[model samples]
Target chain A: MTESSKRSRQVTFVRFALAVALAGTAGIAWMSFDLGIWDQSGPGPGFLPFVEAIGLGLIVLAGLPAYRASSDLLLMPANVTSILGQAAVVAAFAILMPYFGFVAAAWGIVIATAWLNGERNWLAMLLLGGGCAFGIQYLFAMLGTTL
Target chain B: MSTTEALLHGLMLALQPENLMWGFIGCFLGNFVGVLPGLGSSGAIAILLPVTAILPPTPAIIMLTGIFYGSNYGGTITTVLLNIPGEAATAITALDGNPMAKAGRAGAALGIAAIGSFVGGSIATVLLAFGAPSLAKLGLMMGPAERCALMIFALCLLAMLLGRKAASGMAAALLGLLIASVGIDPVMGMPRFTFGQPELLDGINFVAAVMGLFGMSEVFVALEQRLVGKITENVGPIMPTREDLRVSVKPILRGTVIGSLIGMIPGTNSALASFLAYGVETSVAKDPSRFGKGAIEGVASPETANNAFANANFIPLLALGIPGTASLAILMGGMMMYGLAPGPFLFRDNPDIVWAVIASMFVGNLILLILNLPLASMWIQMLRVRYSLLAPVIVLFTLVGSYSISSSMVSVWTTLTFGIIGFGMKKFDLPIAPMVLTMVLGPLLEANLRRALTISRGDFSVFFNHPISAVILVAAALVLTFLVLRLIFARSRTPSFDSED
Candidate 1:
């Protein structure tokens, strides 16, 4: 594999590993806080969740050996930057959703995302992004499904 | 009771002006996406799924189904003319097709493919019309234990077929199962993996996951390549010679049969079917050396198999209400959203709708045959457009498509996250299809397994107690064993399959 490819894989493995670890820890911690005893039915509310978290953790742990043997990190810096940038775009829209309502939020998301994708032409972005938002809003409103 | 009566009733529903128009529109849109690589039936269906939420169930499903198979037919165009496959299923077409194109026989290759697809699709649709109810009845006889075993068999088969490394496939499948275990436990109605996030209480949306894994990942890869240039090449005439037709007939027939059978198997995808058909035709050829060098049979078999499998893949969904692939999974969601169940009873309860849908396939195939010939030249023109223009549009749609699924920005983020992961996996030569298949099947396998165990008083051996379940389990075990043995043997020798991706 190319160096960049190898780095990309490592980054992914590390991110997944961290997510798994955090999930497992949270699950275990949550179980102790509430629901003093595990419920009798098949599995309690926390039982499967904790089990899943631990399972994910173990899988991630197992991957470390493979990662070490492979001679490459799982992710590249550019990849990380892109992933983080994409996440920030979504987060911005999400934080604005309640204040802006669905139309504003949707339009904002479409335009922001399109620009992030490298379409900097203001008119083109608005035409494509704003038009899509309007079209979707119209369709959803007609269907009576809450946006 | 009569065929004429059935046909008339189906035509009545299918030929309604609105329905007919939607069918044409669906076919047209489907062909457009299919001509583009990195887009497939599921993405097309997902993008339009919101539209279906507004329309009547029957017409909505009919249009969506038209798009599904229509895209399959359209995919072969790129594979034959350019060396690029529009979908993985069309990859085999490129083997001989590119050679033929270079030989200035592009017209013949495309013509043979179109004819072969029509013949294959028509046969499979006929089989589906007559045999669906019977197969569904057979499926109904299977209990939860059998279903679980069947799912296991499917996972095993898919791993063997698609995975570069069996261990990694198993790990990926296990991770899918882990992911599926999120949300509230189905039996207890208690949240499991929400981590106190209200949004996660409903669990990760399948649509988001799919969009991320397949669609977003594709965009990331495109970006990484910094691809901004147009790719256009001169394509020759649009008609096949009489000799070309004669040479292609047998392979088309062979591929059609092979693809239909493979498509019936739950986890065997069209790509594998096409590959297998190509391998078979080449091996059995009188002159094997001619196989990759513009052999007409090579083009004929994969194209025929690809379309045949696309049609036959509907069998599992219709019979057991279980989706055998990603696209079918979306169809299942569509059916449920329409408040129409897809199991054995659907056939008896909704014959007119069912038969009309089947009948529409016949019409759709004919439409595609006519449309593809004239449109081939135009589609080739699309390839001339630069990636810089296409990339932004694809990115815009990907974001919009992911967001539209739940109106949740989290889903959009998930798409980008998974896209990067997908790009990484691609770089490492990991097979993404297995991950996709597992992601789709994970929850079904878990739900059925849990249901079977609960029904049998937690007796784990219920899986083995049933005859069908036992047989499927044994088959899965045997396949696993064979794969392990093959790996060991290969490692000890030349390590022929070491190159991943």
Candidate 2:
């Protein structure tokens, strides 16, 4: 794709992301209002949240003009894959932690991240992963908190 | 206790072998993190905050403070040898430092930075010791209305200074307030945005949020960039020539003055001190053209300014419970997690913690000076390590650290979720510091605002009725108006790039 087209795609993505944020803020504002903003004594619990959410929505709307004028692009597709893949590995670590336990789950995280980082040496990755996993276990054991 | 008496007592406590050892470990770990390209002082501190949970409050804070300043010294090593600054403040150091390295004067450059750092840091510590007590006294006089106004001043200034645009910064700060409201409401006991998770009652763990935002996100960026550095220049003698020192003395003193003044200002970047110092040095030079060509004064000024800025930033944090920078904000979070409230009461209630931390700064700077002078090459060798090898270890550390916060999957999930959010924030050019700072200060702001309102029977003018609060609120308004006008004029001229003026 051409540079201008890439720029347009980036702008569209940012606008969509920002629109979602605005909607979320508006929803929170409504919820906070429903909860009550004031009581007999003074400002209630929802007062701060309601004020902040409303302020945020206004700020986002004000910033839109500057956003339109700016030429910056948010994400380059080439780099996004690497970041997303690594994020996925971390997500999987949280998922697998209960079933596989700390050692196995942590070991998978180390190995997968290292592999994704382009460390092609299998034996090296395995040794590093195993060492880190056991080392963490020993640390927690020393601290009297079993992982 | 008197300031002198308290300081002497604190020095004795800092000299204890256990506290000293923790301080040393903090310096070592901080230097290690600062020597690397991607991981910064904030990330390292966030990831290691949980480990401090196992220790006593004094030693834990001593260690964390050591990390804060030690990283400043370590950043000079990469800037001198690899031209890759290990921290944002060190970016100014690379302008002349890299050129000096290419000219075979890497040792002189590094040596000057070390001496400048030592001198600047020592002077700033002395100033902080004398300054913080008086500042805390002033803080003690503040009522809730005044305190709320001060925080408002800080938040508004931070939103304007930290982000590329005031609106973005204001948006981020508001979002932080919303995040802070996620737990059970302190007043009404109603959940704001908890989604019915029992774990949300205690609120989102600050350490988990920071580790995910700064530490894990950094690793993700590193994996994408794949940064690697090779040492090409030999570090000659680890001492500057007498001539070099003679010329650097003035800059060092000037830089210290510049840094010490800037550091106490809430919401200003420590990096701003370094950049200002460099600019001052260049503008005052006999031959300003020699700056980018490897001027010794160039290396000396920013190095000294940054170290001074690092130490001097403690004044605001220790005295008024306000953090001046992102790393200091994390340090404040760590202090709260340890059940220590930082403010005027801290000096009155916990003089031992306050004074010992101050004394430890002196000791940590001495240790860093010794370490950097003779063992500069050891740090340079660290540059040869690849980012690929470090990324996995960092991820594991962050994950385990998050899990250890509550020993549950909830904190870990928080970490992962914030990590992704942090990445998007970075890409979208939103400032993360304002978000983190507001999140840390949100409860205080809310509580104070409510108390003032209640005291006044819901009269919002109570804030304007108090002299201190009125002055501070007016100042905040002026600052906001100035920033908005400046933004309007600047945006009209050109389309700026991300995170830059």
Candidates, DockQ: 0.25, 0.73
lDDT, model 1: 0.68
- Per-prediction fnat values? 0.17, 0.79
User: Model 2: per-residue lDDT, tens digit, B156-235?
Assistant: 77755643556676777788888988888876677877778888887888889989888887777676676666675566
Residue B484 error for model 1, in Å?
3.1
lDDT score at residue B330, model 2, on the 0-100 scale = 88
In order, the Cα lDDT scores of the candidates are 0.68, 0.83
Give the docking tier of candidate 1: acceptable
Question: How close is every model to the real structure, measured as TM-score?
Answer: 0.84, 0.96
Write candidate 1's Cα lDDT for A37-96 as tens digits. Answer: 243323234443455445545655655555655645334435445545655765675567
RMSD of each: 4.5, 2.2
